[model samples]
Target: MMREVLTFRGKATAGTEFALGVAAAVVVLLLWEVVARLEFVAPQFLPPPSKVIAALWTMATTQHLLWHSLISSLRVWVAFLIAAAMAIPIGILMSSYRIVGAPLEPMIDFIRYLPVPALVPLSIIWFGVGEETKIFLLWLGTFFQLVLLVADDMRRVPHEYVEIAFTLGARPRQVMTDVALRSMGPNLVDNLRITLGWCWTYLVIAEIVAADSGLGFVIWSARRYVKTPEVMAGVVVIGLIGLITDQLLRALHRRMFRYL
Candidate 1:
């Protein structure tokens, strides 16, 4: 039957994808193990994959490194959410109103070019040496980027949609709600994905300043004592968490914008 044939083909495709993923993982691990054992690079600087895994396990079990890393990741995500929430609305408003955007354009441009890490001193002064400062720094780094992206997305929405809405006797508010916002969905999701990656990079910088706990703090502490394994372990944790977050965002985008 055609149904049976289609089911078999679907299973075959899934199996092939799974096999490719497993094979890629195995190849990477094998290469890492060989290079580390052969001392192709200083093991201290480039720890073996096995050593990294062992170090990760030890830290996870004994020192709660995983917990610390999770806390840092949560802080980054929270800051990112706050930034997106504030930026998207302001961006929409600016895009929708030329007068507002024209006046603010130069200031926004200036701030966008300012390196966020350089603002750590001011952040520390404003927020003090607390979690607040770290979160604030992360927010600062992500907010401007998302604002510009969202504003651009709004500007690029098809003019025809707005005209059609207007022709239907829709008010400006209705046009924005039904046409402009709907059109901006895919681009907004794309910007969020890009912003999430930016947030990860900024989180490390944020954690470096005035942080008592976090993966970044762990890495910083390890470097002082020359605990390379611990430092590498922290790096691995950040990468893994970032990858997981990105994949989740991608899945959410697919589900929310299925029509796109």
Candidate 2:
């Protein structure tokens, strides 16, 4: 009887948590609809959810939303891969060797503090307002931070584990790969997922730099014309895409790291 009661309570708690999120979203939307319907705020400034949905439908049907969204997503992935590829090896080296870590740590610390939006002017000057500029901006935003995260993950491996590998006739390289990298695999993946979310946070900054298409461009362009519904629609699309990709990454992380 006690076990049955506990089981029922557990399921009830789970159901309540899920329902809370849905209920909160519905309440917010209802409030928004009420404000817009009653003209509590200017219609041009805060369109109703219905208007945003209509704008989304129009963009999806007439404006090739899929194509631009694909481009933005591709740019994000490319930039994230570039950052991860460069950061992982350098981070591993930093964690493994004091000589490598000491000289570069200060520079990386300083660089990570610089705002990514502040780099747009330099990015434009260097990459000339093209796709490369956008990708580079995203890379710059993620790389330094990700390097620190990777190094931290590497450092979390037990020093005793590496010592055991060394005692068993493992070479330095073997200890790095077999002990350090192996132990850090799940953490490295989790860090990558975290940094990927960071990349999405910079999508608007990346896409607004003289961009002609993509969701960010849509938002920027609509703002100039005072198209509130379209602007909100574009913002919604970016959020949805980010949410979907983030969920996918979470699922992949769970599948890859069952221990987590």
Candidate 3:
């Protein structure tokens, strides 16, 4: 196993990979517990795993942790779905016609580079710090990036495939749908998976201001009172959720694109 892991470009079995990942996590947590016990860093600042777990239990039982998790998950999924719905078509349009892409690409490039957190004030003003504002922030963080990725995926579809379609008497629309979209299937899924992760990263920023619920709110509230254990627990919950979400997406990707 050591030799396999040491070998560059060597493929590990799925079970081996899963074992390695679990082992690494356990090792890190053990080290953290040891360090905290030794007071290398103040426990208040860096709570041990046991404290974090205890805090997590308290939150789940009394602080409505599950409710917060559900709300946060809903916000992320809703925004992500909306972003995907809009971005896929826009990206396809941009890639399908140079006339459509020429003007839009530069604007998307500019907007995507603009800091998401900096847009919080504008989002709040436009959407009134309601659920809309939170959703909009998550969407803003995802859409511009995903659209560009989708467009690039479309562009990467081989010209030979398009040429073949055309030679076979396929219409423009048919060529796009049959050739380009079909060819970029794996890449499109990969891009969506990546952009979904980005959406999660913006969750705290989305829920930072005017938020009374969700894991982000819990974390922020705990921080204000210096409740490090609760704060860490909230953060850990987010990390766990993200890890699960990512793994699910990876499973979907593998199941959908087995040939790749």
Best by TM-score: 3
Which ten residues in a row are the worst by lDDT in model 3? Answer: 201-210
Q: What order do you get sorting by lDDT, best first?
A: 3, 2, 1
Better of 1 and 3 by lDDT: 3
lDDT tens readout by residue for model 3, 21-75: 9999999999999999899998789888999999999999998999999999999
Winner on TM-score (1 vs 3): 3
Which one is best on lDDT? 3
- TM-score versus the correct structure, for each prediction: 0.90, 0.92, 0.95
What are the clashing pairs of model 3?
Answer: none
Off by over 4 Å in 1: 1-18
Residue pairs in steric clash, candidate 1?
Answer: none
Q: Which pairs clash inside model 2?
A: none
What tens digits encode model 1's per-residue C-alpha lDDT throughout 1-260? 33543684544456666777898999998998898899989877777888878888898999889779888988888999999999999898888899878887778889989998889999888989888998888898899888988999999999999999999999999999999999999889989898988988988888877787899888898889877888888898998988887899899999999996
Cα displacement (Å) at residue 63, model 2: 0.8
List the global CA lDDT of all models. Answer: 0.87, 0.89, 0.93
Cα deviation of 147, candidate 3, in Å: 1.0
Q: Where in model 3 is the C-alpha error above 4 Å? A: 6-11
Residue 45, candidate 3: C-alpha displacement in angstroms = 0.4
